[model samples]
Target: MRATLIYGLGDVRVEDVPDPVIESPTDAVIRVVLSCICGGDLHSYHSWTDSNPKRMGHEVIGVVEDTGADVRRLKKGDLVLAPFTYQDGTCSFCRAGHTTSCLHGGYWSRFDGGQGEAVRIPLADTSLFRLPVGGDSELLPSLLTLADVYGTGFHAAVKGGVTEGSRVTVIGDGAVGLLAVLSAQQLGAEQIILMGRHCARTDLGRTFGATDVVAERGAEGVTRVRELTDGLGTEIVLEAVGHMPAYEQAIGVARSDGTIARVGVPQYEQAPVGNASLFGRNITLTGGVAHVAGYVERLMPAILDGTVNPGLVFDRTIGLDEMAAGYRAMDARESLKVLLRP
Candidate 1:
């Protein structure tokens, strides 16, 4: 089997690796049909300085090839969506709809990377969502997004309290941020402001639901948002960039008593969250890694019916052997998202 491995920063390779086999009674093996590169993967792709190699990729959709003795929810030939993270459905956190924080859960990379020909999934019954049989091929890309990006964007919107007629500002124009705009609109936000300078991405943001695009940065960006909001910042600010600057911008542009939902993977070791920055303004700072498994089922219908097309984020598709170039294209901002066909 050929799998993607990150040997160091900016060094992704496709190499032959041993095929994964069912290792536990609750595990299942599946042939990966489609997978994708995620923005979070870039963090490791850019900064990983470890000497040891690591498996890459998490967003995956595949067909079950074999099931463990204890697995009953899925079987051979069943198409499944494997959320970026795996969780035991019986855990308290999972029952409470926070599957990302499940007591016995971990990322797909822990067992088998998604950017591979096939993978071994542990806790198959609880970790994988079997897609409806006979779904169209056109829906595959959208269904693939449900495994991560779309669900993540939906999580950001929900956590930020986006509702009918709400004013929303999304800081970051990456795939997740772009989808956040779409999610905000679907949730009924009347005014969506996207803060990003990239022409292509902001254009997609507008199509997604952004009523305004602010191409400014730092304080100027905050000022632009304030101007659009009539001096008070937006009601909900989504920080999707996952950096200190993006976080600060989100904090700066959020109105007093507003909420900032940060779904970006934080790259900083520490963030300032003192009274001067948060408590004094009565601002609610929330958001973390999305509970993708929890949101997938709810969002699947929307994708199936074509109400949302978050899959548009995949600007390019490449064979598994071209994954390194795929990473380069994404890192260079030449592409929004890259889908890999194994």
Candidate 2:
């Protein structure tokens, strides 16, 4: 089997690797159906340190080819979505909705990642969500988004307290941030504002329920948010860009008593949070690595019903062999997301 191997920054190679087999009674082997690149993958694609040759992706969906004896919830020939983090499902934290931090939390890049032909899933019963057999086949890419991006987006809005008629602003227009906008609207937000500059993305955001679009990039962007909210800032702000500037901007655009949900994956060595700047403002800071496990079931119905096409974020699609082009398209921002078929 061929798997994507990361030899260094900006370096990805499709090398023949040994096939994976069940190594645990709780494991299952999946024939990857579809996979895609994520913003997090870009971190490894551009970073010098994350360049260590290793398996590279954490988002994917597939068909079960085999399952271990302990895997009672799934069987061979089932279609399923694999959570990026594997959990036992009975752990205290898993029951508490923190699957990302499960007692047995681990990363998987099937074969090398979901980008491969097959993958061995650990903690099978707990980590895999089997999709209905007769469901919409065209929905796989969108359903695939639920494996990570959609789940993360839902977490961003839920953490930010998006309730019926709440005023919300999503700080990043990347796939996750864009989906956050959709999640907010789906939850009944009356006024949804999207902060972004790209024409295609801003258009997509509007389709997803962005009532207003702010094209400004920096401090000017902050001013726009304040102006939109009558200087009170938005009631709920989602920090989806995992950068210092994006972090501060989320804080800057939020109202004095607003809540800022930080969902962006940080790559920086240090982040500066000023005490005085946030102290007197009554701003509530929330959000972190998303609890994706809590979202799969909650989002499955909506996605299966076509209430959300998170797959719209996938601006391009390619074969697993075109992995390099997929990376280039995302890195150039020429595409918002890319789906890979093995």
Model 1 lDDT tens row, 238-309: 889899999999988999999999999888878878898988999998999999899988888888787888
Which parts of model 2 have CA positions greater than 4 angstroms off?
Answer: 50-52, 110-112, 134-136
- What are the Cα lDDT values of the candidates? 0.91, 0.85
Question: Which residue pairs in model 1 clash with each other?
Answer: none
Candidate 2 on 1-342: residue-level lDDT in tens? Answer: 877767777787777878888998999999888888898888878774652576766787888998888889898888899868788777788899888788886666533477788888899988899887443498888888888898899999999999999999898889998999999999999998899888899899999999999999678999988898998789799988889888788877888888999888876756655565566788888888898876898888888787788899998988878888888899999989998887
Q: By TM-score, who's the top model here?
A: 1
The prediction achieving the highest lDDT against the true structure is: 1
lDDT of 1 at 128: 93
Candidate 2 C-alpha RMSD relative to the actual structure? 1.7
The C-alpha TM-scores of every prediction are 0.98, 0.96
Per-residue error (Å), model 1, residue 55: 0.7
> Each candidate: RMSD to true structure?
1.1, 1.7
